[model samples]
Target: MTWQTGLSGFLAGLLISIVTAPVGVSGAVFLLPVQLSVLHVPNPAVTPTNLLFNVVAGPGALARYRRNGQLTGPLARLLITGTVPGVVLGAIIRVFAIPGPQVFRLVAAAVLLPLGLWLCARALRPAAGDRPPLTRRTILGLGLATGTVGGVYGIGGGSILGPILAGRGTPMTHIAPAALASTFLTSIVGAATYAVLALTTDGDIAPHWILGLLCGIGGLIGGYLGARLQPRLPEKALRLLLGSLATALAALYLFQGLNPSGGN
Candidate 1:
């Protein structure tokens, strides 16, 4: 990559990090397309590079959540249990699911659309005062589903998981941290999976690794600020922003899929 490319990626990462900071996500929703389209990174490098950012940016957010007492121990455990295996499987598929960028973009849009809408609805709806506790079984199911999507997209599934838990009546306060913890765990497995695949098949992924680290640096700062501001922000507004961002990204991916030539 040229110095210009690296600088652009860093700037983009910084902006995405700021946008995602209030939430527990690593900003892959914004970063991946830029890497693929603008930076012209290859398909093989996408997931791994995104995972690198997740690894770098995730810990600080998780730590903040833990410190704030927003992370639920048992819930996080349940989410990790289901997500780990699914993430592993998803990573393996990402390497082999070479139907071209068009197909992949479509698939990504399909997965993101529903998740975005769900988040939007939850944000707009009034918070229910009484809600059922999250059952282990329910968490397992959601985790597995979200993890699989994360594995394919290299997003760590916090975008989907955060809203689901919150909609189900898990306190918004806890949802952010729980999502962060879950994403952190799933990302470990997902990144490892991509690493193994890259080594066994594609040889070197050093460029992606380097870029991922750069992205992570931005994510770290953004995530820290977001965590710090969580208590002050209105829960509804937070959800709305996250959901809107997701929806916009989904649309962009869909547009790219339909007109690959226009992307970037």
Candidate 2:
């Protein structure tokens, strides 16, 4: 890659980290599109590359949550336990059940559209005073489902899980931190699964060593900044921005599905 490409990736990573920090997303929604559209990365490689970014970027945010005592240990453990298995399965599916790029785009649209709308609705709704206690079963179930999606899409999966937890009355304070921790753990699993698949199926599918290093450098800086600034942002405005961006990305993927000739 040229210096220009490196600079662009670095800046993009920084900006995404800043925007998504408040919302508890790792910013794969933003990064994936940029990788495809601007970097001209191929579809098959995009998920893995994004996963690489997540792997590099997730730990610092998780560490921040841990330091602040925001993360719920039981909830995080349950989420990781369920999601790890699902991530492995999803990676297998990515290799053997490899859908056409158009089909994958369509599926991505389906998953992200509803998630985006839900975020928007939650933002508009009034917050209740009391939140229900987090449970093992529910967290595990949600983790399993979201992990599969994240594994396939190469995102943190918190993009889906975060809103659900909030809607279910998890406090934003706890939800954001726990979700970030969960995303970090699950991302490690997903990245490993993808790495295994990439090695067996297509050695070139994910150039892990190079991409991982670059993404890590960017993610580390961004994650640290994002975690530091999380408390100051207005929740409603943050949700609106995140939801809007997710919706837009879903629409862009949907359009790409429809117009294969135009290219992503």
Candidate 3:
């Protein structure tokens, strides 16, 4: 990659993570657009590249959360349990089954649009206080579904999971670190899966290492700063922020899905 492209990747990761890390996302969901459009990274490979970014970038915000004693919890554990395997499966599917960009975009839009709207609606409602914790089965199911999507889309699944949890009344403090942790770990697995697939298969399946690392360097800094900022933001504001981001991404994907030529 050119220096200009590397710099652009860094800036994109930095800015996207600064906003998304506060909501437990590693910002790969946003970075996917940058990779596909501005950076002109090829498909399939871009998925692993995004996962690489999550793997490298996740530790920054996680470290901050750990310092504040918000890093580990039951929610985090359950999510990791389900997402790890699911992401591996998803990577396989991405490489072998559904390699087209249009299908993945449609799937992402279908999932995110309704959930984003629900989270926004919930945020606008009066506080009902903390609801009962989600059942282990429910959390595990969510992890599996979202992780599969993440593998296909190159996200850590936090962009999807965080909103759902928030809409169910989980506190931001609890959601942020947990979702990030899961994203980090799952991305590691997802990236590795893609690497292995690259050995056995053809086409652009492996990540662009230099580009991924450049973006990750920026993400690492941005994530740490965003985590530091998260504590000061009100819960409702965080929800709205996450909701708005999801909705916007969903719209973009929906358009791309409908008009394949435009996305290319």
lDDT of 2 by residue, 31-91 (tens): 8878877866675777777777777777767677667777755656666777777776766
Tell me, what's the RMSD of every candidate? 2.2, 2.0, 1.6
Which candidate's lDDT is highest?
A: 3
Model 1 Cα lDDT, one tens digit per residue, 59-123? 76777777777775677777788788878777777777643678778878887787778878988
Off by over 4 Å in 3: none
Judged by TM-score relative to the true structure, which candidate is superior, 2 or 3?
3
Q: Work out how many backbone clashes candidate 1 has.
A: 0
lDDT of 3 by residue, 1-264 (tens): 799999999999898888888878668877887898899999878899999999889999999999999976788998888788788888888889888889878877876787668768877988777777788999889889888877877776655777788767787788889999999999999999999999999899999999999999899999999999987877577667767877898999999999988788
What lDDT score is found at residue 261 in candidate 1? 91
Off by over 4 Å in 1: 129-131, 203-207
Worst 10 residues of 2 by lDDT: 203-212
Worst 10 residues of 3 by lDDT: 233-242
lDDT for position 73 in model 2 = 53
Order of models, best TM-score first: 3, 2, 1
| C-alpha lDDT score of every prediction, in listed order | 0.75, 0.74, 0.85
